[model samples]
Target: MADIIIIGGGIIGLSSAYYLSKQGHQITVIDKGDLTDNCSFGNAGMIVPSHFVPLAAPGMIRQGIRWMFDSKSPFYVKPSLGGGLPAWGLTFLKKSTQRHVEESALPLRDLSLLSKQLFQDLAKEPDFDFELRNNGILAFYKTEKAAEEEAHLAKRAIELGLDMAVLSKAECEALQPKLKLDVLGAVHYRCDAHLYPVKLMQALIKYLEQKGVKIVRNQEVTRMTTNGSQISSVFTGTKEWKADQYILATGSWSPAVAKLLGLNISLMPGKGYSFMEDEPQQRMSIPALLCEARVAITPMNGQIRYGGTMEIAKINSQVNMNRVEGIVASVPKYFPDLTPAVPALKDIWYGFRPSSPDGLPYIGRSPKLNNLVVATGHGMMGLSLGPATGLLVSQLVSGQRPEIDIQAFLPQR
Candidate 1:
């Protein structure tokens, strides 16, 4: 059996460890933090098979430029010439064509469908009881423009063999009878699902530890020693750890870790914010995505978690209150009564999504290092796509064929 070392303790790393250990491989997971703080948590907890479209799609540049002027806009890219942003921006512009979107649809759909099935399977496991709900998500639109956009997307989804239906305001209200909606119309993506991310991550860590996987928390990889093309050892301060194979699943910090191994990947940290509030009434059973505002509100863990905004900037600790306010302001527009107050700074949680320029994740073997697997750049869908990525990583490590064609997710592409 190969001894494998996985860097990063988020959903991807832990999921990889879970599958790799199931194959009877000796596994070790090392994380820079105590595992509680990562992008895997503080997310919208959406398992979206409906999201086949990548971020780098047509008309995004026009919309992004419009949003740039508004402080409370859902998407923002901080101006910077340093640290790969310029080149990433150029590639993003190049890939934002209709041809790119058309080409990316099938692979993304397949990956999402695979991950949704895997999530269903994982929920059935004895050790897991994370609130895995398959109630689907509602994409609510308030404007005619947004309604047209969603209708077009729903049509594409239906053509690709996905279950989606366009709903009127009355139909949307019937589905969500407990709350009032001011939307013009909505699209019910029957293919999507949701879960509590904290519970999922906790269950994975607990199960892996019980199965004898070494989890070294609060240990950051400071340096690496490589022998030719293979990684000889990894160092965290004075201690050294070695394994037969290595997996780099670090989320937003992947580029920095790859740099240590003389590899460069085009990735930017798209920071997002989330805050939870008590919803004892459980008024919203189905998760709702505000079409124009780009906010996501989901009923999870006896509370409603409101999350949104994509700030493409350097990773930092300061919380942008304007972004959080943007999420809060959008909620009342859709659900007139569901007004959530601006959460205090301490309660607000922000995490960076490792976004690729082409709006697709990088999940494949490194061409430069035979023993290494690169699995990051999942962007906002990291949690939704975690299990599929982990399963593919296991298959890649075992020299078996991947379940899906990973040509679109090549790291060097």
Candidate 2:
């Protein structure tokens, strides 16, 4: 079996390690931070097959411009002048076409379904409890205009063979009888699911450790030494780690890491935050996405997690209070009976998503380095696509064919 090294200990890297180890390969995972800390730990935790359309869809450019001035907007691109943002912007604008969304839908759906199945399979394994729930997710709209637009998207999803229900406000409230909903209508995607992200991450780390996966934490990969077209070893200042194969799963930092290998990958960091509190006074059985507010609310493992905002900017840990406030403010508007006590600013968690220009992940082998495989850029769907990507990585490393077509997600794309 191959000696594989996975960079980035988030969902993608951990899942890759888990699957590769099951194939009897010796796996080593390296992360810049401790394994306990990552983007996967604090997210909406939704396994969303409903999200077939990529983020760079038609009319997004217009919405982005309108949100530019609103600090509390769900999507905000912090004004910046340099560091490849201009190039990424141009590519994003170019890819924001109807054709791109249509082409992306099938692959996204396939990958999400595969990952969801894998998640279900794992839920049955001993000592693998992570609060996996298949109750589905509700995407509710407060205005008729937004609800009508969602109906159009729901139609597209239905055409793709997804199981969904366009429910009236009364229907939504009936589904969650214990809570009151303040929305015009909702679209329930039965294909979607939810989980507790922190529990999953913790369980995976423990299981991998038990399975003898080497996890080196707090060691940042500074550079690599190349021998011809292959990467001989990756260095983290004091030490060098060598493996038969290397995988780049370092989400937002992918572009910077690839720069060392002379590959200009158009990737930027889109930061998102999630704050959890004890189950609210009014509990909802299903997770819901407030369409107008751009916030996601989930009842996870007896706790309520409210997350939103996509701040496309350079990677940093600075917390935006306004953005956090926006998420909390929307909670009351959607669940009228609920009064969510906002978590302390210090308690909030934020992580940068590795957003690609075209909104599809950059997966597959590197053109420059023969032994290196690129597997980052899942963006908001990293949690939703993690296991399927891991399975694909194992296939590639084993010199076998992937179960699904991944042409659109190749690094060369």
Candidate 3:
């Protein structure tokens, strides 16, 4: 078996290590932070096959422009020309076409389904128990415009062989009998599932350690040495680690990491925020996605995690209270009894999602470096797509055929 070194300790990196070690490969996962929290932990924790629509879909540019004016908007791009934002924006504009959306649906659906199945399989293992629930998610809409859009999307999902149904407000109430819904209608995405992300991350770390995988924390990759067209070794200040193969699974930091090797990858860090609250009553059974608000509410670890907003900009440590307020404000408008207060700054959690211009993830082998594989650029779907990407990464490293055709997720695309 080959010795593999994976950079980034988030869900994608750890998942890659998990699968690689399972195949008898010597794996070492290195991260800049302790393996405690990340985008993988503080997310909505929904495994959604229902989310086939890419972020760069039609009408997004028009909507994004309007949202730019509001500090509390669900989507905001901090005005800046630096950090390659202008080029990424232009490519995003170019890809926000109906043809792109139509072309992306099948591949996104197939990838999500594969990941969902893999999660189910993992949950059955004795060492893994992350509260994997297959009850599906509810997309609640409060306005007529949102209702019509959701209906159209549901119809398209059904056409793609995904299980979805349009439900009236009464039908929605039937699903969550304990809580009162103040919405016009909802789309029941029965193909989706939910899990506790923190537990999931912890379980993977524990299981990998038991199986003899080395997880190195607080080690940031500084440089890489190349022999011909292949990567020979990676440096993280104190250590020079050599491996037969290297995988770049860093999330939002991928662009900077790729730049170390003189490669240009068009990606931006889309920062998002989330906070959890005690839900002793457990009023919410199925996870809810507010259609117009773009907020996600899910019950995880006996608490409710309210998360939303996609702030595309450079990575920083500032907490935008307005965005968190927007998430809190939208919850009551949908579920009247489920009003969450704006969390304190200390209670808030934020993570940067590595987003690509075309909205699909960057997977598969790098064209310039034969020994390097790229697996970042998952955006909001990073947690949802983790296992499938990891499995595919292992397959690529082993010189075996991937389970699905990954042409749509090529890194150099």
Candidate 4:
């Protein structure tokens, strides 16, 4: 069995370690943070097969441009004179075509379905308990135009074989009795599932430790030394570590690491914010998306999680109060009876989504580095697609045929 060193202790890295360890491979995971908080911890926690439409879809460029100036908008891209952000933005604009969206749908749907199944399998394992729920997801819209738009997507989803149903406002109210919505209609994707992200991460980490996976936290990967096409060793300040294979799952910071091997991976950090309510007045049995607001609400474990907002900025951990307020403002719009309480800003969690230009993750070996496999650039779908990404990564590492077509996700293709 090959000894593997996995970078970043996020869901992707952890999941990869889990599968690799099961294959009897010795695994080591490294991360810069405490591994308790990150994007993987604060996501909407929805295993969304309905989200087949990638972020780089048609009309997003126009929407992005319109929302660029609004700090409280659902999406915002900070204007930067620096070449890195601009270059990525241009490529993102270029990829926001109908063809890219059409091509991305199948792979995303397959991976999401695969991940949902894998999560189900993991849930049945004795040591793995993370409040997995398959109650489906509701995407509610306030205006008829919005509902019509979603209905169009729902029809397309049906064409792709996803279990989707469009519902009127009354029908939505029937399903979610507690939510006092001002919605015109809703689209329910029965194929989606939800979980408590933090709980899931904690359980995974514990299970990995029990299975003898070495987790080194607070140690950042500084440099990589290579011999021809293979990585010889990785440096992290005080130590030089060698492994038969390496997996890069560093999320937003992946591009910097890739640069060490002379690979140009355009990854922008899309910062998102979330805050959990203490005993929310209203509860949702199924997770729901406020379509116009672009906010996601999920009833996780015992608390209510409200999360949304995409700010394309440099990788900084600073929490913007305006963005947090934007998410808070959206709560009342969806659930009309819910009062806006002062969210604990200090307790609010924020993490950067590792967004790629084409909205598809890079999940294969870099052509420049033979032993190194790239698995970041998942953006918002990282948690939803983690298990499938891990399974595919393991297949690549093990010299087995991949279960899904990875042409769109191939690095340097």
**Each model's TM-score, in the order given?**
0.99, 0.98, 0.99, 0.98
Tens-digit lDDT string for candidate 2 (10-125): 99999999989999999999999997768898889999999988999998999999988887889998778887899999899999999999999999999988999999999999
Candidate 4 residue spans exceeding 4 A from truth: 280-282
RMSD of 2: 1.1
Model 1 has an lDDT value of 0.94
Worst 10 residues of 2 by lDDT: 276-285
- Residue range with the least summed lDDT across 10 consecutive positions in model 4: 275-284
TM-score of 3: 0.99
lDDT of 4 by residue, 1-413 (tens): 99999999999999999888889999999999999888999999989999888898888888878877777888988889773797888888888888988988998988889999999999999868899998899998888888889999999999999999999889988987877888788899998999999888998999999999999999999988999989999989979999999999999999898787777888899999888875455457889899988999888867788889998889886878887788788888878776556577688888899999888899998888889989999999999999999999999999888888888899885
TM-score of 2: 0.98
lDDT of 3 by residue, 110-189 (tens): 99999999999999999798999999999999899999999999999999999999999899888889989889989999
Clashes (N, CA, C under 3 Å) per candidate: 0, 0, 0, 0
- Provide the lDDT at 137 for model 3: 97
Expressed as tens digits, the lDDT of each residue in 2-102 for candidate 1 is 99999999999998998999999999999999999799989999999898889999899999999999999999999999888999999999999999999
Badly placed stretches (over 4 Å) of model 2 are 280-282
What is the lDDT, from 0 to 100, of the residue 340 in candidate 3?
A: 88
By lDDT, the best candidate is 1
